[model samples]
Target: MTDLSLIRNFSIIAHIDHGKSTLADRLIQITGGLSERELKEQVLDNMDIERERGITIKAQTVRLDYTAKDGKTYELNLMDTPGHVDFAYEVSRSLAACEGALLVVDAAQGVEAQTLANVYQSIEHDHEIVPVINKIDLPAADPDKVKLEIEEVIGLDASEAVLTSAKSGIGIEDVLEAIVTKIPPPSGSRDKPLKAMLVDSWYDPYLGVVILVRVLDGALKKGDQIRFMQGGTQHLVDRVGCMRPKIEQLSEIGPGEIGFITAQIKEVEQARVGDTITTVKNGATEALPGYREPQPVVFCGLFPVDAADFEKLRESIGKLRLNDASFSYEMETSAALGFGFRCGFLGLLHLEIIQERLTREYDLDLITTAPSVVYRIQLGHTKTEDAQEILLHNPADYPDPSRIESIEEPWIKATIYTPDEYLGSILKLCQDRRGIQTDLTYVGGRAQVSYELPLNEVVFDFYDRLKSISRGYASFDYEQIGLREGDLVKMSILVNGDPVDALSMIVHRSVAEDRGRHMCERLKELIPRHLFKIPIQAAIGGKVIARETISALRKDVTAKCYGGDITRKKKLLEKQKKGKAKMREYGNVSIPQEAFIAALRMGEE
Candidate 1:
C-alpha cells in the first residue's frame, strides 16, 4: 500500500461566521490536538487580531492523530482556510496542499456568495468535496433544508452530506470518519529530485522565517540545504517542524507530508507564496505548479497618529512583514503627515488587517489615506504603463496626462448576496454607484446580484454601506475583471481653503458630485477646531461645488485662568497651543487634526 493510505489531508472551508473555525476547534479536540479543558474558541486562529475580530485572516495548517472507531491510528493533515475574498488566493494555495475540502455550510443561512465562490474554486482544484451542514443545534437551523439547497443548487448529492453541530459535539465523530474515508491520501514519489510547494509562511518571535511546505517529491530534514526556486533564494534548513496548531520540532517530513522549514532567512523577499522548494544539491528540472508572486490591487498612504511612532510604525511593519509577506509598501515622507509609507494590499480586508496589526499588535496609532486601485495608462499605441507600478503614490506627484494617453482603473466582477426583500434596494444602490449589473439569480428567497464595479468604487466602505442598506443581510465578494474605459477625474481636497496636493482622489466623473459632498462633510468632521472658520472644499480643476465650514470656535479658549488653580488653565492652554501648532495654518484660519482621521471613519451614516 502507498504511504498515502496511512495519511489523510483535507481543509475546512466556509464563509465568515459560518462556524468553520468553531468546528475546527471541536475537530482538534476530538482528534487529540488539544485537551477538552485546553480548548478555546477559534483556537486555530492564533493571531490576537483574528480572535478580536472573530474572523480568520490567515490560512493555518495543523496535524492531528486520530484513533478510529476501529482503534487504528490515522494521520489528519487539516488546514483552516480564510473566509473572506481578500485572502481567497491564499485559500486556493491552502487547498492545493490538500486532496479534499470539508465544505461547511450554515444550516440557517444557507450558501453565501463567498461560499459559492470557494466551492467553485475547490471544484476547479479537482478536490473531492464533503458537504458538512454546521450549526444544526440552533433553534432556527434546518439541516434538511440546507441539504436540499446543496443538492439542488450546488449539484451535490444530499444523501452523502453529514449534519453537525460543532458546539454540542453532535456528528463530529462522523465528520472525522468522513475525513478518513472521503479524502485521498497524498501520493508522491520520494525517488525524484526534491520538490515541494510553499503554501503559506509566518515568522515566530523565537524562530525566524517559518515556511509551511507541502512535500511533493522528496524527504526534507534539519541541515538540508534548500532553495526557493521562484524567489531565487537559498539557505540551509536550520530546523524541520510540523504544526499542531502551534509549531513543534520534527525529525523529518517526507514526500506526501506537510510541515515547516526554517532557514532563518530575513526579508519577505525570500519567503514567497507558491514558490518551489528544492534540494540545493540535486535540483528539480522544473519548478512546481502554482508559482506566482502576489500582486496587490489597492494602495494607500499611511502615517503615524503621533510622529513619535513614525519610526516604530516602520520597524513594526518590517516585523509584521516577516510574518505576513502579503503586505507591500514603501517608506516615504508626507509634507503634512510627516514620515509614512505608501502601502499596497490585495483588497479592503487586507488594508484593514495591516492597519489593525499596526494599531493593536504593534501598539501604534495611525492615519491612512483613501485607498486607490492600480491604474493602466497608455502613452501611445506602443507605450503602456501600470499606474501602481509606475505612478508615484503621492497625489501631488501624479504625472500630467498631456504626456498624452488614455487611462483605465482596475474593475471587479462583484457578487452581492442579499435577502429577496432587499433586492430592489441593492440594485438601486449599485446603479447609483455606477455599477453595471451582469446577472441576477434567486435562490431560496435570496438574490445573487452580480455587477461589474471599479475596484475604486467598492474599495472604501462600499461593502459596509451595502450591508447597512440591506439591514446587515447582505454579503459581497469580488474578483478582478480587467480594466474598462470610463470618465474619471482627479478630485482634490482644499484644506483651510488651499489645495492640499496629498489628499486628492481619482474617481469616476459621474459619481463626483456625491463623492465630493461626502468627502467635504467627512473632512469637516475630522478637522479640529480652529481660530477662524475653516472651509473644506472638493474641487475639480478650478471648479468647486461642495464645501463645509468648520466654524470659528467661540468658547474653546480659556476665557479666564481664574484662581491660583492657574495650573489647570495653563495645562489647557498648553494643550490647545500644541494642537494649534499641528493644525495647518491658512491665510485666516487654523485647521485641526480630525480632518486627517475623518476619512477612515466614513460610511457610518
Candidate 2:
C-alpha cells in the first residue's frame, strides 16, 4: 500500500466551458494514465450528449500516478465536476470526497457567476483551493486581470496562481507541482474500523450496481461483507477497482483512497450517495454525515406522442431513474394527452436534458408541458395554524382561488455576469420578471448583478431570452430562496369549450391577461383549421381572459346551383350553415401532437 503522504485527493472546479475537462485530459496524459493514441478531448466526459453539447453532465473521477520533482511517485485522485447550476449537487458530492480543489478560471472571461458559486461551495467544504488561470494562449487572455478578479470577487488569494493553456501543453508541470506542494494529503487511519463514504452509484448491465466510494478509515478489500449505514443493507463485495480513465483492478482500497466496488446489488436505490459503508461484522457505531436531498425546482408533464408507447415510456423512465436519483416522476393520466408522467427536475436545463434523453436514447416521441415551479397553497380562510397546506406541482391540480387563503411561490436569488454594454438590458429583463435587485457592482469591464426573482418567471424561457439579449456573453446562476406570498392564479386554455389540462399554467394576476393572449395567439397559428370553426379561450375560474377563433374551411356548396334562381342558391347556403353548426356542437377537436409540442414551446421566436 502507498503511504498516506504520497496520495492527494482533489477536484477541478470551474464555470461552463472554462476548460476543467481539458485540464483533466492534460493531467491524465502527463501522468501516463493513457497513451497519446487513446487520449482525446474531454476524456472524462463519457456520455454522447455530453460530448455533443460540449458540457460535462456527470462528475467523473480518475486515479493518476505522477512522479514529482522529489523523485517520489505519488497517487492522485482527481474528480472532474460539472460546471452548470443544474448539476451543482454532483459537484457538492464530489467536493465532499476531496480534501482540496483546483479552481480554474478562464483568463479572457475572468470571474463568472458559476465560478463564484462553485468556489463558495469548495470553501464551505473546507477545501484547500489552488487557483489556476486557464486559456492563457488566447489573444484576449489577461491572467493578471483575472487574478485580481479572483481575489476581489471570490476572496481567494491569486498572487501565486498558475497560468496555463490546457489546450496546449504549457505550464502543465507547474500545476502538478503546485498540487503536490500546496494541497495536503488526506487524513485517515488504517487501524480503525472500515468507514467509507459512498460518493456515487450507477447501474451496470453485467455488474449490477457499480458504486464509487472514498475510504476514510480502514481498507476495503474484495470478498468483504459491507453494510450501508443509511439503508441498513449488507452485501458481499465482489470486486474493487479504480478508474485510471480505465478500470484497473485493485486488491484493496486503503485509507484516504478512492475506488469503486461491485457488491452484486441489483438496484441502485439501495446504494445511496453520501451514505457510510463499513464492514458488516464490526461496523462503526456512528454514521458519517450524509448529503442533503436534492429538491426539484421545476416540474412538467411528459407524455408519449403515441398512446400505445405508454408501457415503453414507463420502462425507459425506470431505467433512467436507476442512474439519476435527483429526477422524480409519478404516473398521471391527462384527458387531452392520455397516459403520461409528471416529472420533477432540479432546473430547466435538467428538465431539458431528461426530455432529450427520453427522445434520443429511448427513441420515443414526447410532448412536454410548460414548466412550472412548486407552490405552497394554504387551504382555508381560517386561522393560519388551523389551515392546511399543500404543495402544488401542476396547475391543473391548483385549488380554487376562493378556497386558497394565500399562495406562496418559490423565489430564487440569482447572480448574473455580463459585459457593461448589456447591463441595462439585463437589468430591465430582470425587472420585467418581477425581480427585486439586491446588489450591483462592477468588476473590471463586466457588471456583477444580483437579484431576487420569482422562480415561476425564471422557469419559462428566461435563460433563452437572457442569452439572446446579451449576445451569449452573459453568465447566470441561481439558488432557490424560500417561498414568498404572490398574487397568482391558474390559467387554463380551452379549445372548442373543452379545457386542455396540459396547457394550464399558474401566472401572476397582473400579467395574466397578456400571457393568456399570447398563448391564445400562438395556438391560433399552430392548430390546423377544421370544417367547423374552433374557438380557443384562456380562462381563470370560469372567466375568459383571452380568446382566438380559427375560422372554418369554406367549401362552396352553391357552386352546383349555377344559373339557378336566387332562392335556390340561398337555400343551399342556409343548409350548409345548419350542417356546420351541428358539426361544431358534436365534433371533437383532434389536436395533433405537433400542435401541443409547438404550443408548449412558447416565446422561442
TM-score of 1: 0.90
Error of 2 at 123 (Å): 0.9
Candidate 1 deviates by what RMSD?
6.6
The segments of candidate 2 whose C-alpha lies over 4 angstroms from its true place after superposition are 381-387
Q: Model 1: per-residue lDDT, tens digit, 1-605?
A: 22667788898878788989889888888878887677789898888889887899888889998888777788888889998998888888888888899999999999888898888889988898999999998999988888888886778886788899998889999999998888888889888888888988877777777889999888888999888787788899999988787669988888888888888876656788888899889889798776667888889888887888888988988888787778788987766778889988888888888888788887887888778887765554325743333443445565665553666777899998889888988899888778899999877788889999887778766888888889988988888878876676778888776777557888788778788899888777677766656788998877896889888665556776657687888898888766664554524443444656666456446
Best by TM-score: 2
> Taking the tens digit of each residue's C-alpha lDDT, what string does model 2 give over 276-394?
99998877888887466678889999999999999999999999988887889999999989999999998988998999999989999998989999999988855444568999999
Off by over 4 Å in 1: 380-394, 521-535, 548-588
Task: Estimate the lDDT of model 2.
Answer: 0.92
Estimate candidate 2's RMSD in Å.
1.9
**lDDT of every predicted structure (CA atoms):** 0.81, 0.92
